[model samples]
Target chain A: MPVRPLKTKVEFPKMLNSERIQVTGKRVQLMATCLCDAFYDDVAIATVQVLEYLGCEVVFPESQTCCGQPAFNGGDWDASRKVVRHTVKAFEGNDPVIVPSGSCAAMIFHGAQIEFEKEADKDSVAALGKRTWELADFIVNGLNKTTWEGKFESTIAFHRSCHTRGTKSSEASLQLLKSIPGISIVEFGEAEQCCGFGGTFSVSFPAISSSMGNLKLEHVRAKNPDLLVSADMSCMMHLAGLASHEGKPIKAKHVIQVLRDALKNIGLIK
Target chain B: MAHQLIDTFATRLRPETKAAVYDGSKKGHEKRTKLLFDNYAKPDDLRKLAGKIKQHVIENLDTYLPATEERLKENGINVHWASTAEAACNHVLEIMRARGAKRVVKAKTMVSEEIELEAFLNKHDIECLETDLGEFIVQLDHDKPSHIVKPIIHKSRREIAELFEKNGLGAYDDEPQVITRRAREFLRKKYLEGDVAITGANFVIAESGRIVLVTNEGNSRFCLAATSCHIAIVGIEKILPRDRDLALLLNLLGRSGTAQELTVYTEFISGAKASTQPDGPQAMHVIFVDNGRTDVLASDCKEILRCIRCGACLNVCPVYRQASGHAYRSVYPGPVGAVLSPLLLGKNFPQKADLPKASSLCGACNEVCPVDIPIPDLLLRLRAKAKQEGVPSPGTPPMGGWAVMASQPAAWKAALVAGKLINFMPTKLLPVPPLRAWEKTRDLPEWRGGAFRSWLKKHNS
Candidate 1:
């Protein structure tokens, strides 16, 4: 099979302002995942800017922090308990705790309930669990009645991380992409498979990790996409690292960045 | 000796080749597992059902196990309980001797691998032949299995052809059908000639004492039918309360393991064939092996018992995809194997301690698991247990560092400061050899000064 490396830079037309006026009276929250805090802070900023541009009140809770996924996944019950307790305290009163990353949101929204079911803090866990939402899921399912005019003229390939596709069952990323006025969304093969950057597993088993990333890289390359976008930065980092190592030309960006850029071109972010 | 087998196989296969095979196998396993979960139960309903079933099984194990044994015995099948792997191996050897069996043809059985049955039988001058195509390929190459369901997944078609040609049993043709036909011709004769056939049961129905074998190639059926005596070796946890439960389980098994509506063959045998049956084994035996299952059953980690051997968890696990199965050096591999293997073989099984750290705790395995063993949880528990037992882990620093950091806040802060300083340097210059594995593939995030608590303190003050 001939492997055509994706071109990172592609020209995009200025979005029309008329479409931006259509989206109004929506509420959203920006969930800045742990990786976004430590590494990809730009993605978090873009997420907030984009949500605000869509006429949604983007609530950024200063108390909101790591989603307790690391401790929960590591089986450290005490640590997980402390983290979830803090998270529940921070976001429980909100209508919807919107998260940019699907996996972290799923962990907070779905996995936390399971983790705290019979614990002493059961009521608090249940309270927060009821309000959690992946950004796309909240936009498509919860805010579906509100129409949004997204005018982005570019080819984008969407990569669905495993947790989002399997656990959360949120296809809103695709729905949101499809709703864009001028963007052509392409599907990558095996989009749901892990990019192999499994938090700690990537470090613990590097050869196997890279091997998995190689397969994902092949998929991303096959599309010859203008840009590869995903809900999670951890996967993007893994794919981008492999792409960089292989000297491939494909650029990876968070879906929120695309939304932010498009909104900017339409003068919606002003 | 088991470690040696794994090392030999791993060395011969090499890391890159093994990695490529692992990537393909992982993709295949993931596709099948997802299809299985989607088809069998409402995606939202699986976790609840899996949790309930596992909880019920663990709480009432003593009650259910005996009920299952009694039912099997009542249906004219001999049921033997083995407390350990050695005991299980001895029990089978005793049966083999009593049957006057000199040769055996076997279907795929992880229990046999758990107890190292083939080696034991071979030591006693009896020949044991693996009949499953993947298994037979691994057997002929004298290599350990790199996958649970597909034992020879590490081998390409060309490798199989080469191996077959070297054995002088077939022509060198790099075609799957040609290789499969050659293996069938070779194993068919052995199956008919063997005195006994041994296979693993997917689930042992507690109500009927029947052993259920699920297979894609129908080789299990041939293995059970062609010999004079048939043996179904299984873990005690394979018991289900009734036949009605089979519908749900079979649905999960087919989809989770191989992504089929049902396996090519689903055979439920309660006992040996009666005199009226012309082509079935005359004597049937079901050996229920406990090994360390009872130990796991007695502890907080009893949820590991609810595993159905579907290999769904393995398919979705990122670590298993990279390292493949042989790195585990056990009959079982992947998320399920990482937790269960150490328990079954005990802490003293050489290099058994390495199994616990083999996962990324991605939760993918838990998501795909039909029975919801909480695989990542068990893996962490095993790691703690291994640390407690003072089992030396391969690439980890001494626990003294962890002890100091965990108990003393000042020490922890100091260590964090040092770690932050180290993170500022290029990862290539980090001076930690153990961390090289990580740095080779990813750049360590540069640490900003100050801890979270410190940052909060400064902002509030």
Candidate 2:
């Protein structure tokens, strides 16, 4: 089964549009992760478009690159430090560095401490760690409190990525999902389990990684949702690949994509 | 004794591909746990629960210990405390000798394994028989348990059949039922004829002085009931403050151990068989073994005392699935084993030092642990402790060499240059064989040609 790619051109608005976020000129930067930069560019675009549609001033630090999760997971602390130092420097002055990928956000938020603990730039890394937020977290918590008027009636299942859900926090994603008026969020059993895509772990140990993905696919199918959404594309890609290969009709989408699609219905985005 | 038993048992069993199956299953289990954890609760909530339980157990252990001893005594049970493994073993031996016990039937007990009880018993001329199905398999083959719960997880049915046949129990059978029946027939006689029965307690209720034993095979139940003298050996850390706590533990134990709602039998023995009860053991003894556990409890590693031995951490651990348990060369094999074994056996056991390094620090063990011991964190601490203690290394290659190198910027820069220069070299061209492990499986990625500091220096300037 061929992987289905989202065709819509994902783009972020330059300013806060949602009446829900009571933003009084606070700046938010979008962290288009390495994977988002290379493969899931649509997710980065969708994240920006949704935040813009929400009426928040959005900035994309082109100087931004990967969050160094790839190196971190591989046990290459120095390589991860290099990437993290770049990331911390890129979003230095931004109030919130919103990352669409849960794994990347987790790295910036929590993993940077471990990655740069003994480095000369540890103090700067620690500062960036304090301000980093997963995009859903930024949308739900960091956003100025505004009652969302957007509504979507479709049933969707949300998958929490391992690092985001297990290591970091999941309340941000859950709260964001709850805000979508009329959209029923179907809860999954054992939903906090990893989707088996441990970055390079999937390819390094394909058979085991695939089996893990297959189990996640089984649970997702159990919910019988119209779409599966998650904070991490690496996990979504793994689950989507298995679901597609098994001939399941369930489609995987980033949480931002779902929020973007909902906003588009309300005429908030073109 | 575990070393000897492992060598003997491993020599007899034919190697199979169960390791591969375990690897796949663990990945699947970890993925499921992550997905479920994400959807169910907040990280802070989970962390709070883990912290609360551990703190409760450690802070008032003194009060709980005496309370539990008094309660057991009130229920007509004798509680013996052993500060060391040798002390524990001698206590059991004295009990057996005083009772004139010649033959003993045993249930699964990691404490017994820690103290090398079988060897001690053998030396004293008392025959000991393992009655639990998995323990029986290991006993018959004269092997150490490869797993805490599933001792024979590394052995396929065919290999078990072969072991049984070698022992004159039956032919090499492919069916589980056939093999189980054969093991039952062989052990049933021992259960009836044995003079003493011994088992491990899953939890020791401090309020009631009751020893709670959970098992699926009914072996422990039969062994506890049929023998004249019964000895329940438990680690001191197994004590809980109240009977009510058992419900929470039992609920999580079964699910975490085997994904079942409950085991087949959950037996609670408070004391010696009541005088009115005709089938109860004539004498009941509960030996609470300290054996370095108090040291662990008193030290910074006290959180490890919270382990309930559910083995959920082992089932979900990626490194354990690959290496199997024997590689650790300890009675405790996975994450909990890696830390606990070193503490129990005194950092001097051969191959003990390698046990701590046997993980990817994936934290899957911590997640599935019902008691929520931060196993990966503990393992790291153990490694640091071992290094500080100057124990012989466990012979595994060092991981995170980069982290150490990165601690020194000049050294890191020089290492990066060397790494870039060697990136293209084949495994055969390397000066050492240790690099082969990484080279055989993964490729070294090309260096980016410049450091982040250099790039930042140019761009920011």
Candidate 3:
């Protein structure tokens, strides 16, 4: 489906009027992340829809592949830096690079900086971090689009991706979800616990990984929410996989995917 | 060589242990968060300050180490330095032999555990009894401490009761009070009969030459009071610059470890009791055990020395919660041990190399650390160090192969196309072992490989 840009200029809350107001017209480079490119293409598509729906021009850098997190996290810095250099060359523009996964975005902003710490171009790499934003953070904080007219009806148990802990993206996703009318967030005990999807950790230590995933799934199941939502699809993938394996599958989505459906449901964007 | 981490983890797959670890650590983590936040307006600032104090001391061990020795000597405490665990254990034995003390009473000390002092002393036919209730139970059961702060966090009350009954402590009684009473009654007698007291210092102040011991039970104090000869096994990293630093460090320790404002007993031992004094130890020996701490300080992860043995990281760690402490297969467990154990192994880092990979890098351990050790960062650094050392990371994917695909767009695109074959491939015949591990508990999402790139092309057109 072709996503058309929203023309209506919805006024943001008066408190945020002094902030950047022209984010709607700003062009953003989409970092579709390796995971989404191969598996969850719909999440990337929905993310583009939501960004365009906020009147921002979304640019997909086709040359971009992975964020080098897998290699970086796996202790192969030489291999990780090679992939990281490729990413640096791919998204070489000055536009803000937006990522749907908080974990991937963190790889750029935090992980890449560490990988390139000793290099001469480290300052430029650090500059890249300043311009990268997780999708929900860009929409809510960057675009100042907190008060959404679109309504979403569902009970969501939001899994705060552990990668989002240091970044503002986790709070941004929750804020966006809460601002939308008709959506009730089902709060569970130990809501901030990780779903054991530490990229390679999911596979390397599968038994322990699944056990941790099962603990999270138990909490998510206790609330019996209609959906399990998170800002990072990697976490959602691990969790949904675990939930399904246990014979009770959960409907998990990225925050942008949910927001896209909410806007589409309200006839706000086509 | 394959690392022992996974092999050790395989041995600790008991359901009862996992359940106990999960419940115990979760409650500890929650309690720490609540207590720290409720008590301090800016707990992060407090944690940062605590970290700064420990970091400063660690960085200046050259200055503090001699100063501590000087002050401790001036205060009439015999100062002995041990460069290895064997040497540390031998020093204790030498001290005991000189004093002709066969019966030893002990306070909980992870450093002694690191040195395997009790077992060493046992081989010498020296009776060493654990005075702390948790240590008593752990000694009774001949089990390694699964946690730094709580020794038997892996054991349920039922198991403790069974162990107690089997050991002839009493009939089966799972009541918490009864268990404590049984241990207290049994241990109170041993304290008086014990000839030498051995304890671990939580912090040794360089300025005042005092060793600080924080315990919920007054067992350390009892051990000190009951014995004329006292021996303290102190890790060289436990030195603090000033006594004033204890205010903040102690606050962080109590709140972070067990959520108490202060432990029940906080004793500061200045020296052996003077000639005119009534009680306390007549002679005191402090063994400064290096045992690879100096090696750790000289390494890239020197900041791990800032650890206070709080076990806050273990409580917050998801891996530690599920696998329990035995999985790490080290004297220290959880995130702290993941970094320290391997480093402490010195030339044998490969033995515990997989400890670094055992973590999911969730960053909770980093967040919960009282001294603000960047645990995840340290874990990553250790992994890198292991790779550089050619330590085998069995079951881990070859990052070089993935990097080749990721760095070149054409190869990446071709790989994406190949990823579709995963959907058709039977689980029994999956090419990658990690993928087989992945498929054990989770179904893979059907491959929609290269669809996004095609859609982007179509949409832009």
Candidate 1 lDDT tens digits, B285-346: 88888888888777656777888877777666666665667667778887888887777765
**Global lDDT of each candidate:** 0.69, 0.68, 0.85
Q: DockQ (C-alpha) of model 2?
A: 0.05
Which candidate model has the greater lDDT, 1 or 3?
3
Q: How many clashes does each candidate structure show, in the order listed? A: 1, 30, 0
| Cα-based lDDT at residue B451, candidate 3 | 92
lDDT of 3 at B267: 95
- Binned by DockQ into CAPRI classes (incorrect, acceptable, medium, high), candidate 2 is incorrect
**Candidate 2: residue A240 lDDT (0-100):** 73
Worst 10 residues of 1 chain A by lDDT: A10-19
Q: Score the docking of each candidate (DockQ).
A: 0.12, 0.05, 0.30
Q: How would the candidate models be sorted by lDDT, starting from the highest? A: 3, 1, 2
lDDT minimum window of 10 residues, candidate 3 chain A: A9-18
Per-residue C-alpha lDDT of model 2 across residues A1-270, encoded as one tens digit per residue: 111221222111101112122334557877776555444656777776777766766776646556766556544455566666766777878376777876777676656665454578787876676667777766666664334556677788888776663533356666666788878888876564567666544444444345456667788788888888888877777677666556664577887887777777788776
Fraction of native A-B contacts kept, per candidate: 0.18, 0.00, 0.61
Pairs with backbone N, CA or C atoms under 3 Å apart (clashes), candidate 3: none
By how many angstroms RMSD does model 2 differ from the true structure?
A: 10.9
Candidate 1 residue-wise lDDT, A1-270, digit = tens: 111222222111111111111223366555576567555666777766666655577666555556776555544445566667766766655466677787787676555765675688787776565566666666666566233465788788888775574433236676666677788887777655678776545554565567678888888778888888888877888888777756664688887787777667677764
RMSD in Å for all candidates = 9.8, 10.9, 7.9
